[model samples]
Target: MQQHPFQISRKIEYGMRAMIFLASQPMDRTVPFREIARRMDVPEDFLAKILKTLVERNMVRSTRGAHGGYALARPAREVSFLDVIEAVEGPVVVNVCQDGSSHDSCKATGSCTMYGVWKLGQQRMLEVYRHATLDRLAMSDLRVPEPAPEAPTRPAAESRRVE
Candidate 1:
């Protein structure tokens, strides 16, 4: 899906899910690829790419060989949401105008009425994400809500006219 200005990419979302799952698991435990994929409901192939980026960023560690899997490189408390987002998608920019590389492209750099708005918005977002550590998220009740029970259905013959 194409990501809007504020919306995070699917890769970043999946990476967050994967990170939360790992943080919830015992620190000593290394979760396998299949298990993370199943629990996060993330496609294995896509998740592999996300994981690779995270591993490269030093946010996640991968183990090879028998009984091998993945785990956070550091304690969950040390890893923040911003870290995960930045690992998968570079510095979190709320607007293109905030991105340094795109600064020259925009006709209005210092004169734009919305520049301050975007700057403040990006600052606030970064602060929130930076403070949202994985340990806190993992400790919260983030389990998927149970599916509601199905309503009772009428028997096929009951509502039908005999004629």
Candidate 2:
């Protein structure tokens, strides 16, 4: 299998999945971690770390006890893709030149011809991300399909042929 050059990290991917699931669920209902993991097909341990990051960022709320679980801290409409991505991956940077901290490293920060292009691209990317809120994603037709049941096999002895 070929790997894509530009791809989100597993952390970000899983975080998005969990967020969407939570958004789709009733705001009054607290979903269990196991249910989220199973429905989203994310590893439990990996989901745990992602959830921890989200919880710390105040994007998700966690509860303790039998009926307690997890839910979105804010309304789904208030949370955007940028929020989730930035929550997990930090600020999105199109290139090293776009990073303020790396401006000193790049000698052509101000004079590069491609600077405008990178800036425009970065701006557009962030705009799209900011526009894609959890509410929109949850409402989209992106549900995980249930697995098909396995067919029953016949006994080997019943398949014997007469000579």
Top candidate, metric lDDT:
2
* lDDT of candidate 2 over 99-154, digit per residue (tens): 75756557875777887788799899999999999998894444444579999988
Candidate 1 TM-score over all chains jointly: 0.79
TM-score of predicted structure 2: 0.79
What TM-score, over all chains together, does every model reach?
0.79, 0.79
Runs off by more than 4 Å, candidate 2: 1-5, 101-103, 139-163
Query: What C-alpha lDDT do the candidate models reach, one value each?
Result: 0.86, 0.88
lDDT agreement of model 2 with the native: 0.88
